[model samples]
Target chain A: MSHAIVAPVVLPALVAAFVVMAARFDLVLQRTLSIAGTLTLLGLALHLFLLAGDGVPRPYLLGAWPAPFGIVLVLDRLTATMLVLAQVLAIAVLLYAVGGWDRQGRHFHALFQFQLMGVNGAFLTGDIFNLFVFFEVLLIASYGLFLHGAGAARLVAGFKYVTVNLVASTLFLFAVGTIYAVTGTLNMADLAVKSAQLGPEQSGLLRTGVALLLLVFSVKAALVPLHLWLPGTYGVACAPVAALFAIMTKVGAYAILRVHLLVFGGDDLPTAGLAEPWLVPAAIATLLLGTLGLLAARTVQRLAAFSVIASMGTLLLALAMPGPAATAATLYYLLHSTVAAAALFLLADLLAERRGAVRDGIVAAPGFPQLDLLAGGFLLGAVATTGLPPLSGFLGKVWILEVVRAHPAWPWLWTALLVTSLLGLLAFARAGSLLFWKPAALPAPVDPQPQARPVLPLVATGGLLALPVLLALFAGPIGRALEASAAQLHDRRGYVEAVLGPGRSAAMVER
Target chain B: MELLFASGVGVLTAVGVYLCLRARTFPVVLGLSFLSYAVNLFLFASGRLVVARPPIVGPAAPGYTDPLPQALVLTAIVISFGMTALVVVLALRGFLEAGTDHVDGREPDREGRS
Candidate 1:
C-alpha cells in the first residue's frame, strides 16, 4: 500500500499535462521541465528498484479497493528494473533531442512524457485491462513522436506503424474478451488461480485466448512475419524518438515473460507452456531474418533497426526455455540490448548529421565534420552491438549460451546465436569501413554548410555507450540481481499470494 | 440471440481483415475502424447478453449483467476512437506529403517493377 508504487505512472502524467498546457509556447521552459521530470523519474525508479530488490511484492490498491475487484499496481523487482532501464534511456534520448530534434515538431516534450507514463504504467499494472489501456497510451504518444519531423518518409512509415498496431490492439481486445468470458476476471493473479482450475469444456477456449494474447505480444515484440513494420518505422523515425523506441520491443518481451511465467505456467493448467512450443522456432527465424536484414541493410539506421530485432531474438531465444538460469540470462541480455540499441540509434544520427547529403548511407560520401570522434563513437557502439569481447553484449550472449546449454534444443539455439553474432559482426564491419574508413571518392564540396557537432548530443550518445561498459564492469552484481528477479518471476505462487492475501489465494485454489 | 451476436462479430471481422489487406491508406483506415467496431461488440458480448438487467449492484434486482466488460468496452471504444482519428490525420498527411495514397509511399507499379 506504499504510495511510491504509483509515482512512476502518476508523476509522468502530471508532467506531460503540465508541459502541454504551460510550456507549449516556451521551448526553454519545456526542455527544462521535461529534463527535470525525467531525472526525477529516474531517481524514483532507482528507489523503487532498491525497495523491490528485497523480494517483497508491493501492491498499491488504488482508492483503498481490494485486489481482483479494483485496479492495483504492483511494483516488483522485475518492474523496477524495467522502469529504471526505460527512464535512464529516456533521459539520454531527451537530452539528445534538446540538441535541436525537439523543435522539429510541436509537443515533443509532452508526447515524450506521456510515452514514459504509458510505459511505466504498463510495467506496474496488475490487471490485463489496464495493460491494454497503457499500451494504447504509449501507442498514441508514439504516433505523435513518430511523425514529429513531418517528412514524407516518416509520414508513410508512421502510417504503417499505426495500422499494424491498431490491428494488434484489436486482437488484444479479442483475447481479453475471451479470457473474461471464460474466467470472469481480468486481474492477473486472480486469473492465475481461475485458469488452473478450468474445466475441460472451457480449456479449449482459454487456450485459444492465451494463444491470441501471445500472438498480439509477439507482433509488438517484432517476431518474424509480424515484424515487417518495425525496420521501416524505426528507420524513418527521428533519431531521439527512435532511441526511445528501443525499449518498446522490450516492453513486449517483458509482457510475454511476465504473463507466460505467471499465469499459464502451473503444472495443473491445461494450457501450460503454450508459448514454449513455438517460441524458440519463432525466435530463431526472427534471428535469421534480422541477421539477413543486417547483411542487406544499406543505411546505418536500418542496420541499427535490424540489430534491435536480432537482440530481441537473442533474448527471447533464451527466454523461450523455462528456467531461472535462462530467464536470468535473458534479463541481463535485455538490459544490454536496450542500452546498446539506443546508443546505436543515437550514433547513427551523429553519423548522418556529419555526412551531409549522404545521411547515414553505407556508401562513400564527403565527410562534413567531427570524423574521428564520431567514428570512434560508432566503433564503440558497433562493437557493443555486435557482442564483441570486453563489452556487456558479449557477456550477455555468453551467459545465455552457458545457461541454455542443457536444453534439448540447445544445439539449434547455440548455432543461431553464434551465427547471428558472426553475421552481425561482418555486417557492422562492412558498414564501419564504408562509413568511416573508406575515403570519399568525390572532391570537397564547393558550398559546404557549416556543421558543428553539438556537445549535448555527443554527450548523450557517449553516456549511453558507457552503460554497456558499466554493465560489463559490474557484471557480477548485476547478473546476480537479474537472477534474483528471474527467480521471483518463476515463483508464481509467491506472486499470487503477494498480490492477493495468502489465505484468499489458498481458498480460491481450494474452491 | 447469441447466434445473431456471434455472426455479427464474425462477419465484421471478416470484412475488416479483407479491407485491412488493401494497398491503399483510405481502405486500410476504414478497415481499422471496422475492426475496432467488431472488437468493441465482441468485448460487450463477453459480459453475456441479458435483457431487463441493470449492471449496477442492488438488493432488489432480479438479475444483472457483468459490469466489468461494459467498462472495458467503453474504454476500448474511447481508445479506438482516438486511434482512428489519429490514423485518419496520418493518412491524410501521408497522401498530402507523398502525393500518393499507396501504403508504401510509392506507386504500386514502381514497387512491382523494382
Candidate 2:
C-alpha cells in the first residue's frame, strides 16, 4: 500500500522508457503498451483513492532521504482525487488517439506516458522544486505533442505557446529562487511552518515570490491577460491532444489549491488572503472574455477553446473563495469542466472530420455520417459547458452559487456569473445552430470519399459524454467525498505533520 | 558588487521582456534566452554572493556557499537550453511553412482590417 504511492509516478515512467526503447518502430506494440499502462494507472488511482479515505496524508520518502531534505510524494484525499480524475481522462484520451491520431506523429505513446509521469509527479510531490521539475516534464512532452502533426497553423501557434511557457518557466525559477532564499527550505511542509514563524520583514519577499508563482500558474490556467496563447494553441491542435490538454489547465488549478491555499493560507501570515482582492475579479473578466470569444468564434474548434477558458473561470472563481464549501464546489466543478471540455473538443473534431471542405467552420456545411448523433452529443457537451440543468455543469454551478453567499461581494459575483453563464449559453446556442441547424450544400459539393467507419472515435466520444451524466447521478456520494477532501485540504497542520512527522516541522534548524 | 550584479540582471530582464513583446519570432527567441540568463544568474545569487567557498561540510573546507541554488541553476540552464533549441527549430519551420517571419503567420494589416 505504501509502495502504491510511487506507482502513479513510476509506472508510466517505466512504460514510457520501455515503449521508446523497445517498441520504437512498432505502433501496434506502442498502443498496446500505452493502453495497458493507463489502465493499470487507473486501477492504482482507485486503490489510492480508497486508501486515502481515512483522510491521513501518506508520505512516501524517495530513497529514504527523509522529508525537507529529499523529495517526498504524499497521497492524501485531494491528491488521490486528482489522480483518479487524471487517470480516467487519460484512459478515454488514449482510447481516442489509438484509433488513428497516434499515427500522425512518432513517439506519441512515449510522450504521452511521460506526460502522465509528469502530471502524476506534480500531484504527488511534496516539494515545490520537484513540482517545477514535473511541470517541465509535462510541458516538454506537451510541446512535442502540440507540434505532433506539424502544419503551418500548428507551427505558428506552437511558437507562441512555446514562447509563453518559456517566459513563464523563467518566472517560475525567479519565484522559486526568491522563495528558497527566504524560507531556507524548498520543502512545502517546512515552508508552511517556516512561513508561520516568519518576521514581518520577510513577508514582502515571500509575497513577491508566491505572487510571481501565481502569475506562472495563471498562464497555465489561462486566466485573463495571460490567456492569449490558449485559444490559438488548443484551437489548432488535433482533437486528442486538445482533449488531453484539458487536464493541463486543471494542473494549474491544483497547484493554486495546494501551494497558495495550503502553504500560504494561515491567518497568522502577512500574506494571508493574498489572492482575495484580484482573483475573483480576474476570474470574472476571464469568464466574460471567454464567453464573448465563444460567440465571436468562426470555427467549432475555437468555440470549444474559448469555452475551456470560460469553464476555467468558473472553476477558479469557486477556488478563490475561502472555506471548505467553496473548495468542494471548486473540486466538483473541476471534475465536471475537464471532462466536459474534453467531450466538447472531441465532438468538434468529429464535426471537422465529417465536413470535409468547411472543416467545422460554423458556416452552414452539408454534414456527413452520423450527423444527428453528433448533434445530440454537441447538445450535451454545450449543456455541460454552459451550466444547463440536468447535467453536472448545472450542479457544479449551483454548488458554487450556494457557497459564495458569505463572500463580501457576493452580489456582484452573482450578477457577473449569471450574466456570463447566460452569455455562454447564447454563444453555444449560436454555434450549435450555425453548425447543426442550417445545412446548405457547398457551391461545389464534396465528393463522397470512401472512409472507414468511425466506430472507435464515436465510442470514445460517447464514453466521455457519459461522464457528466454519471457525475450527476453519483453526485450524492461524490459530493460527500469532495466535502471531506476540501476539509482535509484546509487542514494544513495535518499535511505538515504527515510529511515531516509530528513536531519536526516547527523546529527551525537554521542551516 | 551586489549593485552591479542586480543591475545586470534587471537590465537583461528588461531587454528580454521588451524583445519578447516584439512582432517577429527571432527577437522573441533571443529575448527568451536573455531572460533565461537573467533568471539563472538571479537564482545563483539567491545563495548569496560568496566566492571560492566549497559546498562541503568537512573541517578541511573553510566555508560553503549554498550548493542547492547551483544545482537549481544547472537544471534551469539545461531546460532553457533545450527549450531555446526547440523554439529556434519551431520558428524556422513556421517561417518555411507560412512564408512569414511574423508571429501571427501573416503580414500585419495597415488598417487593422481582416
lDDT of 1 by residue, B30-56 (tens): 999899999999999998999889998
How much DockQ does model 1 earn?
A: 0.95
What TM-score should be assigned to candidate 1?
A: 0.97
Clashing pairs in 2: none
Residue B76 of model 1, lDDT score = 95
lDDT of 1 by residue, A346-395 (tens): 98898888777789999977665777888888888988999998999999
Off by over 4 Å in 1: A440-451, A507-511, B110-114
Q: Ten consecutive residues with minimal summed lDDT in candidate 1 chain A?
A: A502-511
Output the lDDT of residue A79, model 2.
Answer: 96
**Worst lDDT window (10 residues) for model 2 chain B?**
B105-114
Q: Write the residue-wise lDDT of candidate 2 on A311-347 in tens digits.
A: 8888899999888899999999999999999998888
List the pairs of residues colliding in candidate 1: none
The top-ranked prediction according to TM-score is 1
Clashes (N, CA, C under 3 Å) per candidate: 0, 0
Model 1: chain A TM-score against the true structure: 0.97
